[model samples]
Target: MQRQSIPALTMALGSTIVLALLGGCTSVTPPAEPVDVVISGGTVYDGSGGEPYLGDVAMRGDRIVYVGPQRDLAARRTIDARGMIVAPGFIDPHTHAEVFLNSPDPEQRVNAAWLAQGVSTVMIGVDGGGSPDIAQAADRLETGGIGTNAVPFVGFGAVRSRVMGEEDRTPSGAELAAMKELVAQAMCDGGRGFSTGLFYAPQSFAETGEVIEIAREAAIRGGIYDTHQRDESSYSIGLLASVAEVIRIGRETGMPVHIAHIKALGVDVQGQAPAVIAMVEKARAQGIEVTADQYPWLASGTSLEASLLPPWALDGGNDALRLRLAQPDERARMKADMAENLRRRGGASAMLLTSPDLAWTGKTLAQMADLQGGNAVDTALAIIARSLEHGGGQTNVASFNMAHSDVDLFMRQPWVVTASDGSNGHPRMYATYPEKYDAYVLDRRTIDLGNFIRQSTGKVADIYGIEERGYLKSGYFADVLVFDPGGYAPRADYLNPRELATGVTALFVNGALAVENSNPTGTTAGRVLLRPAPANCQVRPR
Candidate 1:
């Protein structure tokens, strides 16, 4: 113990030399020779926004090995895709399927609803409600065997709750460190990025600095930042400012940013679509990577409590809010504030209750209130009180808070991609893609079909950095959809929301038929996409 002395610089240099040598020799071995699955005689869009062409695609195991004339391909299985448009399976960039998977219903777990809509892959844990155990969840689903590939985001709310409990406050120094470590662990566990609903409780308490710090970790780890920004409604620190915050995060932290469910909500921000678009474009011009998703409808959905009550009333948790609602004077003030919130959102008539009791499912708030023999605000309060009493906090409600014209304006932007913000909300789960195709492509002709396909596929894949997906190249994932363009349309409406969309004939997930002849084959062939670190960042193929 006393005899040997090591030279500090010499040892350090020796270790560095050893690491450099190891790094220089590191290489990825090519996958073993793949099993071929051939798809023949199809009109392929390829998801690249390139023109549709007649060709055949050959798949080797889970990846596409060939996409050419299909003249000389031999395979164990051949799908006759003649007269169908074979393109990359749609990627839903924003979804809440993680919550559904936690449900007791088996149907909810697999999310066959999305599968029927030609969605082969989904990004789950959006809007501040995801989990750190996303890999375990994916494994559970894979082990249990479900349809569709799912990638998850580490949620801001979940991380905040873990670090700060249910209280609304800024993180203490140690808590901030804990939150950062949780985020890093989540990324290391296979999360694609971080998602925040800054408008929601717990997360709403987070200051911009805290968000930037956590997002910077994600960026360094090669993850994107997706946000449901602080506000989407009023011009006062709303749409423009919120969009600016996303851009600021991207610039400051060097993370690519995606604005979740980007919209100009409420009448105040109605005609401000162009201004918002200009803000995004300006940020892009300054070399900030920013993009957004829209749901193809004017109305948006959220918890009734969050939508109606002022942010202050929601400061603490459900218990504090219930106490305030019990006091007569506080109740009166809360009602007044809620009325103002309703007015800001358009009107009571504009609000539709998507989930109350099963009986109230399809009713508008005004109608439900009328049935309850009181004003809409009182009825909403009653529902909230009853839900609290029954241990059912925060019923889901849809506010007709968007301008159809504004939606059209946003959809026309080249950088704007399509998403459902998919959740229990009817349109998101049922009609998101087909509705966009029907509305923008077929009905109004605002955007051509090619652009629609591009927005749904390659554009989203490019934005989120999904590998070998969202395209039909010679060597890509064989996640493909075959649909009749003329027949494609969303069949679900607000009243009957759970209806499966029609017109997609077949879907292939990892070269295995997932949806066959308008039916789900119930195959779970999706792989968890663990993106490389920033130092080895792969530019997602265009």
Candidate 2:
């Protein structure tokens, strides 16, 4: 014993075990297989809404090849993931990552903020804000270099803006056909589907029939329709009716419908989450596929003009709106309309100005108005005017319109997945996933860890028909994460809006280490994902 080395001791112990078991141990123990990377000794949440089990995950190239209990898996690189949670890297189904990834700045292209929170794939062109030129977009992202995988939606806003130039009227036959062609081409070129922000301008001008037709094009091409519904409150058709409209689109088009940032917003419809859930459930029962994504925030972020102005007022673009705001008769109508809109949004106190241009990034509309020596409406009008002068409609506001109860209720729905709807000025852009985990799973116990991972990863992938990703299944793409259980949290808040989140210990994108020790490895290993061409263009008959 004094002369025996550790290896000799181990060999003697193994021989004794083998002799005791009569070769049972030898028969059961498989030979070690070498892999590119091995993540060992972690509690694995498979991202299938199931219970977690202690296991090791091994990757070869860009694919996961093993997911089971402690295997003798030899690897080029091994991650000692003891006392950590190994999960599928989160898929952000809604994010404005394009705004940064496409920017000339290389620093923002890494998207370290999202990477630090364990996001491996980001869905862009959400809320009707993507390009119709899918091929060109893919080229742009590839040329610019991206940190997280990017999937795109052909934005309804872009499509309409291209063809109609913000016209308030219905498209002509030629324009409609042109729009449909653009959408079809986009789908064929790898666009996930047609994304419409009907709540915003231009797309808002399109009627139900127009949306149905446009959505049908994507549907026929095996694409899903993702929408920021026409109304989430009393802005136009109301929240309940907007839900019904989305259901109608799905039912009529025979396409899957996914509501982006689904919520019952404002004081007027604060408690309508149940109604929305009922509608989606009923549609699902009737053989319609309907799903939704929501960020874990009580307030919804949007432009000041988009949230308050009537769609008609935004017709003919910002120039026309500014002209109207200058006319006394027009201003009266706008004021009257905005007052009701503000009321629907739970009044001035419920809105927070989030634009960095103004000196009120974290202050409520009422407080900002008081400081500026005016009522909330006048203050808003002035800000919008000033924002227009800057040659871009970038007046962002964090509308504290949703109730916590409604948010919690929506979070409990099975069909509801997680998304950021992330934009520049909002905290949700950088903090959504971690915020959801910290507040909902860790702190509140509202949702368990397994289901949380499922909603944030697999469920989103499944809903979008994203193949070879999302779940931590063997043979799947190895987009994975390892994180400390106690250390997972978001650092980005409304005041420090652009700060990156913390707590992700490591993230692997396509078998490459993209984030290590809660920091980006400066590795731009992401690829652009595209939809496959549809087998048939046949849609259900009207």
Candidate 3:
């Protein structure tokens, strides 16, 4: 039988007595501490490559102060994150966002698309392209008010061009000394590392010995070596040899090495993921810290010239290449070389032209050829010539050169981190993280949620030695994200490359709200991250 409820006074007195007995005469427990922001009632993934747990996260100023069940914690602002996943904000280890960041337009400066994907930091000056004057570049980016935090890399190409021009020859003793000085100065000026697009001209002309010597400067100053290795296809040295070159650089320099956009690019190199992985594994076993990054898509974005022109053709520079193309004999030789290059790239049908100057921004090379009533090679040549004449620098192409199996294989490796390598005219620029999250983690189930987050967040931060970020832990920077796990996905695609993604509910960069309820707050709270001294670099023996 149900007993009548005790009187209000008796009930209150009984609870007080119970609490006192439980505490054994100790003072009453204090109320939870106050915080600046509290994200309550959510599943938390701490970015440690472990299972998520239900908990609360509290932040004050720019750092996380509490991460657990904090029912009594008081915050000036509370975000009810019920049924959502709360995790550390994603970090893009490789990106070209600096171009957009430097734009005078406020909308462009906000970097809203990437912010919506929960990216709080981007490592820029990648693929060997940033000002050699690191301090000046950092100052400009800082003054511009970017939305995502930025870290600068000193470009090997930029330095090489500065000292040697576009000529393809070994540097003289004085020139080599000058280049080394530039690298050291840039590192001192807050560059995170040395970045080289050795796959492209000028840098490609540099022998492996030269790269190792230049990278040594960064290594001594506490910087990693990040590279678009000399070749990813059967281009000159082949992908396997390029991987070995990267390992040699790391070994000689005594610094960590990172391969940008690691992949089995092109049909010639497809299905070689195992070989590539083995090389990297051997390097790691020898105590050299080696890692790589990849985007989710099968297609890789590059300028039309980069896709088809042999490194030798670009020896003198753009002007020289154009001059050569004008000569009938040189044009004939270039056409033959381009035919083989196109075949290695999986044929013209697989290459989609995304250049704005041409009328065929979304058409495949085959389609463009058909439209122009010409063969694929001739059509490609015509497009390049037109782009040079009146279009622009170089028309963009999305080369569908990767194998799905190879992409999956590389992605499963623990050392492989996620990166956008994102730039304008490609959907990857807007949708990289979400595509990986949705396609691989949710739909394909190739990777679990915790591992996916780890690859994109903590792993990247750890690899780059970014300070006080990439984890939801006490005393860490409060760059955080809250999103609907089931609904979070990318909306951008090839046809509509600029469409912003959907499903992020809230995002915070340095404790400032950048996005709320899937809408932008128009806040630019990003900071310029400097290279932490190499003492923190992870160097472990196998």
Candidate 4:
């Protein structure tokens, strides 16, 4: 200024005075020691496919600074982890936590149901139901304080619904453009990837070319494409062709493809697991980025409408579909198609109502039919008609459509990672991790403890490109779990679906204790994970 401005002069004087006081204070006081939290005397698995070893892990602030013998180290908190298995917290690759958040109970908020099982992170918005406002949802969860961290994948169904309702037709040029714009906006807003459910309404109408074009947009942004493929049971298009489509998209667009709930449903598809595995192996051999996730259970859960109705019958939303159901001519066509679909799904006797009328819970379609003195087909149609009348409410049903041999073969594959496919009606939400450990590792002895943990943690993290997490490494984010391996078990069953699992003792997120002594601290220390972000985005072992 012409003369130094008064405020600028005051700032200069203040800076000089502040610097002098800081110097005096620094000289007068000794430097404070580093803040470290230590976990002592435990078997460390580390999640790197390494042999387990006994050691102590030390954390400074939110990062792990040391992982070795702790005789000479000092810390503010020293946790005794004797007789416990210390590993990276489990990451559930597929979940429906977004729906649970719609409820108002704080205890039920963000699915603390998974926390006690040592799951610190969950991938939500799967099966074509993730939100476009992913960043805003993450902010809300963080502000509300969730018990576990969550990452969202933008759903094609939600995007399509926004662009064109549930109409059963191809998207026009303008509609397609609007869809692409919405996807781009979601990705820019921190969505990890794009997901689609081809078996569901609206999305079912999309041709392969449409899916490929949209997938390319996500690929450009370094996102993955996950799908509930069009068919998993029959050799019509077959599992091979379905998997091939996913691989082709990845190869063409340079994006990774993940197959959700990899399985061959129905007796005809039994023993076909090896062929599917070989196909995935060959794709990976050719340098296509491909992977898959599976829930341990043989039975799968979905809505009664999804599992039974022909795709065309569900083309429009509830109102239009109900109108079609009301016409006798339309009703006969739908009933015939429903009969064939039910048979293709292994019959109504194999289908159990997961979330029906309170009076019908645990009853099979066959049982309901018998009680009403009508055939199973009629009973099933009546249930769907009632649900449509209620404005398209969701009803859960379990399909006993998978084969045991197929389940074992998939579980043994080195590349097959574990996911819950967890949701409201499915017991996987409450029991996936522990159930896998108990069934595949303990009961079947198909995989060892080390291999199982690797599949659940490190392998999943690698597939999704999650950094620093899924391993116990120095200078990584301090997301850790301590559990009694011998004491671990799952308590929930289909009949008692809401019970919690047992044996995880402590869980830490970002150096803060989120779960202590099998109890949640009710703190939401989770962060939103965006694509192309560095590995330092998560808490890992030091």
What TM-score, computed on C-alpha atoms, does each candidate reach?
0.89, 0.92, 0.92, 0.89
Query: 244-273 in candidate 2: lDDT tens per residue?
Result: 999999999999999999898887788998
Query: Candidate 4 at 177: error in angstroms?
Result: 1.3
On residues 171-242, what C-alpha lDDT tens digit does candidate 1 reach at each position?
789999988888887776667999999988888788898999988778888889999998898623777888
* Alpha-carbon deviation at 507 in model 4, angstroms: 1.2
Best lDDT goes to which candidate?
2
TM-score, candidate number 2? 0.92
For model 3, how does the per-residue alpha-carbon lDDT over 284-323 read when each residue is reduced to its tens digit?
A: 9999999999999999999888899878888888788889
Q: What is each predicted model's overall lDDT from 0 to 1?
A: 0.78, 0.85, 0.84, 0.77
**Full-model lDDT, candidate 2:** 0.85
Q: Model 2: residues >4 Å from true position, as ranges? A: 1-33, 535-542
Inter-residue clash pairs, candidate 1:
none
User: Any runs in candidate 3 off by more than 4 Å, and if so which?
Assistant: 1-33, 533-542
- Which parts of model 1 are misplaced by more than 4 Å? 1-36, 103-107, 533-542
Question: How much does candidate 4 score in TM-score?
Answer: 0.89
